[model samples]
Target: MKPENPLTIGIDIDGTVTEPSSIVPLMNESFGKQLRYEDCIDYNLATVYGISDEVFADWLDKHGERLYDVAPVHGAADRVLRQWYKRHKLVYISAREARHLEVTIKWFSRYQIPYHHMDLIGSHDKLAAARKWQVDLFLEDRLENALQLAEALSIPVFLFDTPYNQGTLPRLVQRVTSWEQVDALVDQLALEKANA
Candidate 1:
């Protein structure tokens, strides 16, 4: 079956549109430990940093605002998203706390990244939001989220490749290294949907 007009695209904020390694410097500075993005083998920061969940949460409480406010957008994300906004419904769905919505919106405005909707779900589970929006495709950075969403929605998930998410993916999940590749894949998917 063909997708509807103005295909709804569910996108992640932190590591997808934003630089995947943006938080490494902040973590190192805050924890007084040397850690690299390449060293992040798992999605859990507590596990990656060898800290308890409570300690990690405390650190975030102290510095999460500044860390998110200054995070850089990924290369070509602004340009590509602006173009996509004209033809597709760009819905940003993130696990960022709802309290950060103001700063998050500010960041988007500061970078001038286009979007039709934004949902700060405060949890890693995004299937609810994806289903609510009827998202046709998902762009993500978390490996498990991508796989889960693909299985739930039976839709293609373009996972922005990062060290934490490096692993084998399901058939519906594709690892993408750049926004340009994302653009190309979206076009290809749209074309296929159109022809189908």
Candidate 2:
């Protein structure tokens, strides 16, 4: 069955649409620390890298734009999002600073990622933005953000699986390993909504 109303999907850009490990190489080269994506068992990179928060913040301040400029899309993300672009409104709600918007937009253009709207909230708290957008579903890579959005918005959230986000999840938050799985789940959701 076709969707009666286009679902507004709130998506996270960095680690959700982009490869979760896409920043690893840049960080490794910048700080001269040998770090692999698998070694990132904690979402807090400062904790994972054993660096002070100030140090990490400084690094991000200096390199965040370039990081966004070069980060690669996650596997199958381009294909899946392009398909959904036809049926739903994809709103990218990211924690990146508003200053990074230009690079972010350029990144999307460079990669041909599809989005109907984009919001760089500049912080991890996205409840307000999600509410404003009236999202029916959300996609995220951060465990905290996923849990918060799922509980607060009462919306189903697809949490992209990452080494860092292995914590227990609430029923509303589903862990997905790839964009292919996400695509299938979205199809199931549309069917369920149609049935209802």
Candidate 3:
């Protein structure tokens, strides 16, 4: 059931809002990690760099503040977040960790993303938190999280496309190729909800 309060939007980070693919190459080059575009989901740069999870987690402990410099995602993300910020309750549910919280806020302010309730999830299991938020609509880029949330919460999830997520998405989650399509989809969803 929809919350009686204003609809809360759960927005994903990385591929959804920030240029996650862009960062992969940067991570490969800068961190000396050899991660491919496809390997980023489960293990990510840590595996590519031959760094163990413990080491990578330690690195985050040391350099967590640097994530703010992550590049923007082609202006579509900021545009959507800004529009929703004025009308609905918005929470940025990022796989990005709590250690990076300060830098995340600074980054959003620096980039003018127009979101306030930023959540740094400990686990990659987004569906667990999505249920807790009681989101009306969830926006994400991964086929896994989108489809899982769709089945679990019956919430409409918009799955932003990437080379990896292609052909693997389920029917319950709508696929969008670009941020423009995401905006249009959100608008349509808002209108439908209003009418209903």
Number of the top-ranking candidate, with lDDT as the measure? 2
Candidate 1 vs candidate 3: the TM-score winner is 1
**What tens digits encode model 1's per-residue C-alpha lDDT throughout 1-196?**
3336567899999998889889889999878889888999888899998899999989988887898899998989999999888888899999999899899999999998988999999889999999999999999999999999999999999998888898888899999989999999988887877778
Stretches of model 1 off by over 4 angstroms after superposition: 1-4
Error of 3 at 103 (Å): 0.3
lDDT of 3 by residue, 27-56 (tens): 565576666776755434565567788877
Clash count for each candidate, listed in order shown: 0, 0, 0
Q: Model 2: runs farther than 4 Å from truth?
A: 1-3
Report the lDDT tens digits of candidate 2 across residue range 24-47: 898888878999999999998989
- Of 2 and 3, the candidate ranking higher by TM-score: 2
- What's the TM-score of every candidate structure? 0.95, 0.96, 0.80
For candidate 3, give the lDDT of residue 28: 64
Candidate 1 local accuracy as lDDT?
Answer: 0.90
